[model samples]
Target: MSHYKSNLRDLEFNLFEVFGADRAFGQAPFDGIDAETARDVLAEVNRLAREDLAASYTEADRNPPRFDPVTNTADLPEAFKKSYAAFMASEFWRLDLPESLGGTLAPRALWWAIAEQILGSNAPVWMYSSGPSFAHVVQVEGTEEQKRWARLF
Candidate 1:
């Protein structure tokens, strides 16, 4: 039974004490949101990641996915599939996305707080799901449609 350690205390400190993100989230896009909501979100993410998500890691590794040359697709072990199915069932990816994109309007700093847990656990998994973070960058640099695609595509 392996466990991953996340620097949640540091994240909280940065959010509330250091960077004062709590205050920032209280205005504009985060006007209605508060530090308590951020803490609740973090706690939930931590519990899910530690309980449900971590349960899949060892099983998936012991039985890694295999690529099918004929089908041009990979076939993961049944165990891995089942485990990942449960993982996706958690809807971890949809945590802080835009409501239009089926996500809640959580502050970016809060998202970072959640990310630290997932990243600390399986860095590659975190790396693979960089769409939201990258989309933020692209939206800043890209045209209006491109920004729209950040949510659409």
Candidate 2:
């Protein structure tokens, strides 16, 4: 019942072989995460996406979400919410985000590579996963004082 499929082989190829990400790891920012850890993270994320995300996909499509004009909100099905929570529990959204925001900083290309795989499995979940990432970017680009505000946010 799972339509979600990921190409982990190609992802690893792009990360280690094609991009030479191994050279960037074991250094500042990425000091703790090397190529192996990155691959493991990717594999785990792929599994969560394929199993949990994929399972909820069809149920959500069948039930769908309802927009409440009165409340100016869209009510999501419990099944869809369950899928979102599963992805969140995976904590893979933290990749590429700053450690301050609970993310392990990795190469941008590597980050996007794994992220794209999850997105392909379920785009709506990935779309909502951008909040902390946006905040992290603000923290990095913001002034010193603004950094505190970003963290608070």
lDDT of 2 by residue, 1-153 (tens): 687778988888877898788788777867878877877888888888888887777777787678889999988878779889988777777775777777787778777877777788888788777777778878989889978777765
What does each candidate score in C-alpha RMSD? 3.5, 2.3
Candidate 1 TM-score over all chains jointly: 0.71
Q: Who wins the TM-score comparison?
A: 2
Residue 123 of model 1 has an lDDT of: 48
TM-scores of the models, in the order given: 0.71, 0.85
* Global CA lDDT computed for model 2: 0.79
Clash pairs, model 1 backbone:
none
Per-residue lDDT over 1-153 for candidate 1, one digit per residue giving the tens place of the 0 to 100 score: 646765667878888998888886657776656778778778777776676556666766676667889989976556445544554566656655655556557677877787777765544456546566567656667899888887754
Question: lDDT score of model 1?
Answer: 0.67
- CA error at residue 133 for candidate 2, angstroms: 1.0
